[model samples]
Target chain A: MRIVVLAGGIGGARFLRGLKSAVPDADITVIGNTGDDIHLFGLKVCPDLDTVMYTLGGGINEDQGWGRTDESFTVKEELAAYGVGPTWFGLGDRDFATHIVRTQMLGAGYPLSAVTEALCDRWQPGVRLLPMSDDRVETHIAITEAGTGERRVIHFQEYWVRLRASVDAEAVVPVGAEQAKPAPGVLEAIAAADVIVFPPSNPVVSVGTILAVPGIREAIAAADAPVVGLSPIVGGAPVRGMADKVLAAVGVESTAAAVALHYGTELLDGWLVDTSDADAVAVVEAAGITCRAVPLMMTDPEATAEMARAALDLAEASR
Target chain B: MRIVVLAGGIGGARFLRGLKSAVPDADITVIGNTGDDIHLFGLKVCPDLDTVMYTLGGGINEDQGWGRTDESFTVKEELAAYGVGPTWFGLGDRDFATHIVRTQMLGAGYPLSAVTEALCDRWQPGVRLLPMSDDRVETHIAITEAGTGERRVIHFQEYWVRLRASVDAEAVVPVGAEQAKPAPGVLEAIAAADVIVFPPSNPVVSVGTILAVPGIREAIAAADAPVVGLSPIVGGAPVRGMADKVLAAVGVESTAAAVALHYGTELLDGWLVDTSDADAVAVVEAAGITCRAVPLMMTDPEATAEMARAALDLAEASR
Candidate 1:
């Protein structure tokens, strides 16, 4: 099977782990969200891409679902000692290698796509991981400080990591997305995909940011492949992350049916929500997107694999 | 008293430590060699300046005579794991922070001299540390590669660290030295100094690289101060490093008299050699340079301080 999946960080990585387990032989193309990429200490850090790479390549910290397993914080600690930091973003010693290599390659004139390929060579992630764009497209959140009451826009990392998404997001903007061309092979992967999946990633910032790329959303809409999406929301709250806060920023309700409607029948043919959200299946189907309710809690690889299998089944049903 | 010393890496750092102890209350200005600075992994690694700072700041590894006292190689190991390396140079995790800070400051448009001063504000090396130039002027060694017989120029770090100076250095070239202007305070320090000293650093690459700056050499020659130098050679061999190898590159022998003669009477007023090189005193004196044989081996801080005192005494005698 040739499958293309749009992925964010942790939740998406966990779903990818399950997808790989479900179809070990599938030729997977992961269009990793690059909006979370930030330059820390002058090193380019791609959190989402690294998460997917580490998760699939068996190097991810299973407890955290992000960064490398057995990682040390010597580099970060030393950087802090030198008073150089965005100290809130924990970049471990092992994880830093990825950014160093990526940044070095980027500085040497290799585009982010080629650098991603080079990094994946070491991880052997088994899936082709392409960043949404070679061009810079940072996701920034418009927020007001709870105590200071100062309202301003901050980079997505500062909003997510430093602020911990404590305040409501007024707007989530992908700064350079309108000018960004899909990284090499992204549009091709969408067109060649037998089935396209949006794993359990934040709709407003993760998969939403990927779609923000100028050519990507249009390419997937025109492709012959059936587009399937899994709800990051379980019941009424996010399975992981502050997806609801960002969902509200874009005027979408944090519900399975609303998420399906947010993607819309024009693009999405299938939607998968948790079994607890079964009643919303009819609501989504009423809007023309084929909906299925499955056990969406990724408690383990097997349970997550079952979720992936259900999403593929929905894709077939839509066809 | 205002004193200026030109320095290299380990040898110069060790000498500066002694100089600080010898003249505890004297205002000292060090014109550190930047020729050995190299960009490794896209980070500017200033080995010489760092050596002086760390050695004097109580953070240097006493046994290794370089890098932090309690250092970790996690960053370097991780970089190597990514196959991104010139792995021979041992840059510890703590050492990496200095480079990261420096590279960031340079990227942000701060000149290298300003960056060095800011770094020293933290190290408090007890003496003013100024890079010889704000501009890039890497010391390149021309040599024939072993086995391959490739005659080419390689960075001084590659020559010293990777090649181990096992191959003969045909020529030592400070690539951009000719056009480079001395850093803001370097010429002024030389002009205003009561005395000037050349520590027992490599003449061809370390102190020699500093003198390669056009107006700097002219400035020191015309300075009112008596210019004295301590020979890096003892019993016709380098006290440390492959000073002999690079000295051979410039057709100078690794003897106290030869080194003093190479500096010439036109600029050098006094020369200090090790007690074991007492025989060279007559030869150096014959060349119209005042010569003294002192215990130049910096066995400890006290011994090094004594050597510094002797160098000052020679400066006094020359005056």
Candidate 2:
């Protein structure tokens, strides 16, 4: 089967690792979310793309599920010593090389898609990885300071990494999404896939941001294949990351049913929720999308592969 | 007395360290050669400026006389793993931070001089550190590849570090020097100085490259202060670095008197040669520049301090 997966950062990367393990023969196309891409120390850092690349390429810190294994912080320490920062973002020496190569290629006039392909040449992530768009699309969060009641917009990374998402995100906005065209092969991948799966990633920032790219949503909605989504919110909370904060910003309840409803029947055909959120299946089914409950905690590759298998089964059943 | 020194890399940096010890209270302004600066892995690497900063700031690797002490090469190793290279350039993780900060500032539209000032704010090298030009000025060496005999120009760093100056440099060209204006504060420092010294840095690439800047040599020549130069050649050989290779490229002999003659009497008022090259003193003086012989080996800070003192003494006697 030719499968397509929309990935975010840690959670999505972990799920993709499992999906690869489950169906080794399947040709996979990963449309990585680039909204979380940031310029730190003047180098382009695509956190989500790197996470997916490293996880699948066997270079990821398995325990952290993001960044490189055996990473060193000498570069970060030296940068801080020079008083240059957004020091809150943890970029290690090994991870810095990825950004350096990306930035160098980007500076030399290669589109993000070409750069992604070039970077993947080294990682050989076993999938054709494409950024959601070649053009820049940054996710900026609108937040009001608690101490001063001052309102300001900050980059998604600053919101998540620096502030730890403590302040309530008033609005989650993908700044350049409306105008962004799908990267070169994105629409083709969606049209050609036997099944498209939204891995257990942040709905508002990850998959949602990818859909926000103008032609991508229309392509998936119009695709012949059934589209399936695994709920990032296992029960009433996110499996990892502070997805609840951004979810609330978009007026969605932090529940499997609400997340499925947010994606809607027009775009989604099947939804998978954790066994704890079994009550959400009927609610989602009533809304016209086929829903299934499964053991969704991606505790290990075996557990994640099972979740991948369940999502694929749901997609097959919907067909 | 206020002193202005035109410096290259290791030799100049070592001399500055000695000068600081020689005259602890004298205000010093160092015009660092920028022609040797190269962009590696998308980061600006200023070899001369960094050498002076690290050496004086007490952060230099004493053995290498350049780069940071207690450095790690994780970033370099990782870059090589990604197959992004000019792997010959040895930039340590700690040293990478300086380039990152510099490149970031340059990208943000700050001039190279301003970026140098910003970098020096952390180093507190005591002396004012100024790049010879805010504009890009690279020293490209014309070399005939030994095996291929392909005549092409390569960056000075590649010539120095990668080839180790084994190939004969046909010509030494400061690529952008003709149009490059003196960086801010360079002429001002020269004009206000009580005396000027050329530390035994490479005449052809170091002090020569600095003089290649449009207004710098003219400023020093017109200034009231006497300009004294210490010959890098001790007896018949360069004390450090392959000054002989570039000197040959510039059509100058690798001798103490020949180097003094290369600078010429029009710009240089006094010259200091090593006691071992005492026989060349009268030959240099015949060229219309006052000449003196002194023990010039920078074996220790004390020895280098005496050389700095000897150069200052020459400047005084000539005045």
Using lDDT as the measure, which candidate wins?
2
lDDT of 2 by residue, B1-319 (tens): 8899999999999999999999999999999999999999888999999999999998999998888899999989888988889899999999999999999999999999999999999999999999999999999999999999799999999999999999999999999999899998999999999999998999989999999998898898899999999999997899988999999998999999999999988789999988999999899888899999999999999999998988888899999
Those runs of model 1 whose alpha carbons end farther than 4 Å from true positions after fitting are none
Give per-residue CA lDDT, model 1, range B266-319, as digits (tens).
789999999999999999999999999999999999999999999999999998
What CAPRI-style quality would you assign to candidate 1?
medium
Candidate 1 lDDT over residue span A1-319, tens digit each: 8999999999888898889989999999999999988998889999999999998888899998888999888878877877777899998988877887888899999999999998888889989999999999999999988989999999999999898899999999999999999999999999999999999999989999999999899999998999999999998999888899999999999998899999998789999999999999999999999998999999998999999999899999988
| Fnat for every candidate | 0.65, 0.94
What is the C-alpha lDDT profile of model 2 across A1-319, one tens digit per residue? Answer: 9999999999989999899999999999999999999999999999999999999999999888899999889999988988888789999999998999999999999999999999899999999999999999999999998899999999999999999999999999999999888999899999999999999999999999999999899999999999999999986999999999999999999999999999999899999999999999999999999999999999989999999999999999999
Q: Residue A39 of model 1: what lDDT?
A: 90
TM-score, cand. 2: 0.99
DockQ of each: 0.73, 0.91
Give the fraction of native contacts in model 2: 0.94
